[model samples]
Target: MSVYTQLTDDQFAAFCQSFGVSFARAIPITQGIKNSNWFIQTTDDTDGAPSYVFTLFEERPPADIEKMAVILNQLDGKLPVAAPLAVIESEAARTDNDKRYVIHYEDKAITLVPCLAGAHPEQTTQAMCHEIGAALALLHETLQALQPSEQYGVPLYPWSDVRDRESQFMPSDEAKLMRDIWHAYTQLPLATLPKGLCHLDMFADNTLWNLSLNNSQKGEARLTGLLDFTEVSAEHYVMDIAITINDFCTTWGDAEQGESVNFDRSKMAAFLQGYESKRPLGADEKRALPVMLAKAAVIFWLLRLNVIHYNRTEGRTGDNIMVKNPDLMKRLSAYHWSHVEKAQNTVFVLLNTHSNTDQNNQIVGVFSSITQAEQAREQLIRDQLTPDQLSNHSHFLIKEYTLDQLL
Candidate 1:
C-alpha cells in the first residue's frame, strides 16, 4: 500500500468512529504500490478492541471496492481473510438495498478491516510453502462454488494493452522474451483447464505466518492471513498455482557473477503435495505448468515496469511510494525458460528399453516411440519428485508429457 491520498487526523478519526471504534493514530503503510493504506490503532481500552487496516481506493472505483468487500465477507472465517467491517450506521439502518461495508468518499471508496495477526516470513520454509499451497487451493474451491458473474471477473492478463508498454519501457531482448512466453501460454488448451476465481497476487509479502515456538522440534509455521484481494479474478486454477510458486519457491541471492534466483526443489515438491492433498491437478494443468510459470513472471515484470512508467509520466513520486525492481522479474523469467529448455532438450539415448504393450507389427513402431518418449520425460519427472513419490504420480506425469509433446 502507498500514500497517494493524504488523510488528516480528523478524517481518519471520523471514519473509525463511524465503525464504532475510536481512532488512536494512523500509521502509513508503504509496502505495496496500488492503494493507500494505514495500520489503524484504536483509543478504546476495551478488552476486545481490535486494531484495523484503513484503505483508500487509489486506482479502483467504488463499484470494484464493493465487490471486493462482498468477496472478502464470503471468505471471512473460513480463511484468514481481511473482510471489511460494516459501518454502525449501516448496521442500524440495515436494508437489503444498501451496501454496508464500503464508504464512498469524494471520488473513491474507503474500507476498514480488522488487522490480522502474524508477520511476513523473511525466508520461506517448506512447511510454510505447504500451508500456503493448501490454502490457495481451498480458496479456489470456495470461490468457484460461488459462481461469480463475469462482470466482476478480471482477464488472465492484459496482453493487448501491455504489449505496447512493454516494447516502449523494456530492452528489446527483454520485451521479445516476454512476447515469446506470452505466446506459449496462449497456445495451451486454456478452456479445457479447470476455471475458477483466483487470488492472482499470492506473494510472500502478502501472507502472514505465525513462527513456531520450538524451532528445534521441526515445527511448521502456521499461515495466519492472506492479504490483498484487489487482484483476485476468474482464471485457470493452474495459472494461480504458477503465480504462487514463482514467488514462494524461488530464493534470491547475490553472487560474484550477479544476482541469482533459484528454485528450492524440496519446497516446491512440498507445496505441490499439499495442494494435491486438497484438489489433485489434472493432466492438462500439469502440462501447462512450465509455460505458465514463465508467463506469471512476465506479468509481475510488466507490472513493475508499468508502475515505474506511471510514476514518472504521471508525476506520482515521493518516499511514500515504493516501486519494485523489474530486472529481478526479468531474471526470474529467463531462468524459468532456461530450466524448461534444459528439460526439453534432454536426450533419452536409450540403450535398451522394455514395453508392456504387445501390439501388431504396424503399431509396434508407434508403441516404441511412446516408450522412448516416456524415457525422455523420466529425468524431468525426477527433477520434480523423488523416486518413492514417482510411483504415485506416474500416470499424471505420462499424460502430461504426452500432451506437452503434442503441443
Candidate 2:
C-alpha cells in the first residue's frame, strides 16, 4: 500500500532480473524514513549465494542519490557500513505498471547491498562498547585518509544548526534552557576540533550484534552488523563517539529492573582508551565532548516529543527510526544532563551516604538522606558554618581539628 514498499519490491525484482536470476520471493525487512528494505532470495546463482538485501531510497534527490550510489559502490570494500551496491544502473532500468514504483523521485534511483550478518548487542556489556568504539575509531581513520567533496556524501544536521527552530518543540522551561545552552554551544570556539566521517546517529537500532548459538561452544558473542547509512556524513567525528556513549549509558523504566544492565564506567573508559590508541583527540575536542553529549540528548528528547505529537494519534504507518520511548528519553536526558552538570561542577565521584567513604567523614553526619546534600549546603549558609563543620561531609575527608573555631 505504501509507495515506499512497492517501489522497493519493484526495484528488487528488477535487480534480480538484471543479474539473470529468477526472484522467487522478497521478504520485507526494515522500512525507514529514507528507504525500504527487503531480503531477496533468488535461484540464479549456483555458487550458494542465495541472499541479498534490496534498499530503495524514498527521499534522496536524484543528484544526491546518484552521487551516493557511486560513493557506496567504491567505498563498500573500504567501510564496515550498510551502503548499497548497485546491481542495476538507472540508465538501463525497467519500468513497471505501477508508476510510483517505477518512477524515481527527482529522477532518482535505488541500489542493493549485501546485509552484513551478525547480531546486535543488548545495549549492555563492556565488550559491545569496546567493539563499537574501536570500529568508530577505525572509521575515523579511514575517513581521515579520504578527500572531502560530493563523493564523500557529507551530512547536514538540521536541528543543531537551527536551534531557534528546535526550541519551539521543547517544554517552556526546558525550552528556555535549551535556547541558552544551544546558543552557548553554537558559539563555542571549536576552531581545532577534529573532523572526519561519522555515523552521526549510530544508536542501538543501527548496530547489529552477533551472538553465540546456544548449542555452540564458542564463548564469544559477535557484535558486527550495522545498518542505515543515510545519515552517514563527513563532519566533526567526535560527535559519533559522544552519541555512542550516550546510548550505552541509557537506562529506561522498570522493565529493565533486575537486569544485568549497568553503565560500567570501565566500558566508557575502555572505549576512549582504545580510540585514543588509534587517533588522539585534541585538547579542545576533549573539553567539548560533555557539551556535545548534552546536545545529543536534548536533540533526541525534543525529536521524541515531535514523534509523539505527530505519530501516536494519527495512525500512520512508517519506520521506527525516530521513535523515542518517553520514559527512556526522560531518563536518558536526565542522566546526560547530570553528567554534564557534574563535569561542569568539576566533581566526578560524589561522597554520598551510598558511597564507601569512611563513616566518620561521610555526609551522614550532616544530612539524613541523599536528597539532603542540597539542604545541607543551604543550612551551612543559614548558620554560617564551614563546609567541614556544616555536616554532610563524606567520610573520605580527614577532619582537621576544629578547636581553633571553638576559640
Candidate 3:
C-alpha cells in the first residue's frame, strides 16, 4: 500500500510550531522510490540558511529506522556520508520523544535530514574517479573505528530461495540455476577474504558532485558531497568498487552510441592511486578481488532481474533495490557470460603464478579492450567445453564449428 501523508495548512503550522520554526512552503524535493521525500523551505532565506529533507520511510519498520540512524551516526564523519539528524531523543537518551527523537508518520519513522547541496553527475572523469577512490579508501581506513552493522537478512539472497519466484518462471530452471549459483557463492572463500565497509549500493545517483572546478574531462569533476548511506552493508571495500564500476563506469551504464560511460585508464589509475594513498591493499586483498567481482556480478544480475521478473506493474514493496535498468541488466548478462575470459584478458605484465592450490593461483597479462575480449570469447567458445576441459586442453575449438552452424 502506498503511504499518504497530508499536512493541511493548520496541521503544518502546528507541527512547525512544535519545533519553534516556521516554514514558507513544503516542496516535493524528494525523488521518491518506495518512500516519500519532501523539502521544507523557510520564508527567511538568507545567503546560507539551513534546509531540511523530509524522508518518510513509509514501509520501513521503526526498528529499522532506529538501527539505520544509529549506523549513520557512527559513520557520519568516518565514511563519505550524509546522515540524518533527529530532533527527538529516545527514552534511553533521557530526552524529549522517548523514542529516539523520531516522529511516527503513518507507523513509519519520519526523518528530517539536513539537506546537503551537490550536483548529480552525468559523467565522471579520471580526477573524479580519483576522488571517489580516495573517499572509498578513506572509508575503508576508518572501518575499524565502527562496529559491523546488524545483519537483518542474509547478505546475498538468490531468487531460488523464494518458492513463489520459482513458480513464476518456466519449469523452475531459472530458480534451480540461481540456487546452484548461490551454493557456489557461499562455498567461495568469503570468510577468509578481507572485510571492511561496503557501500553495497553506491550507484552514481548516491554520489553528488559540486562544480567547484570544471576541466574538460568528466572523471576530473570536483568533489562535492556524497549522499545516501542507507545501503551501507558490510563487506570488502572492493565490492563497493565492483558495484560502482558496473553501475556508472562500465558498459552497462553506456546506453547510446555517443553517450558512452567513460572509463579512462588514467582516471581509474588515479582512483587506485588515491585509494592506495590511504590504507593500501595487501597481496591477499588483490587476490580475492576476482571472486569479489564475481559476487558483485551475481548480485547485480539478480537485482536487475528481480524488478523485471517479479514486480512488473505492482508497487515495489519488497525493495526499490533494482529499478528497471535495461542497460544495467544487459551489461550484467554480458559480464556473466564473459567474466571468466574477461578476467584472463585483463592480465597485465604481471606473471601467472600459483602456490599449489586453486585459490592461491594468480594470472597476469595486459588488459584487453572490450572489442578484443568479445572476439576472443567467440573463438574460444565455438565448441562448448567445461572449466576443467578448457583448463587442461591445449587446443583451440573454433575450427570444430562451421560458420553456417555458428550462424
By lDDT, who's the top model here? 1
Which candidate, 2 or 3, would have the higher lDDT against the true structure?
2
TM-score of each: 0.82, 0.69, 0.67
RMSD from true fold, candidate 2: 10.8
What's the lDDT of the predicted structure labeled candidate 3?
A: 0.52
Score residue 8 of candidate 2 by CA lDDT. Answer: 51
Leading candidate by TM-score: 1
| Predictions: Cα RMSD each | 6.5, 10.8, 10.7
Score candidate 2 by TM-score against the native.
0.69
lDDT (CA) per prediction:
0.76, 0.55, 0.52
Query: Which scores greater on TM-score, model 1 or model 3?
Result: 1
236-261, model 1: which lDDT tens digit per residue? Answer: 88888988988999886655636667
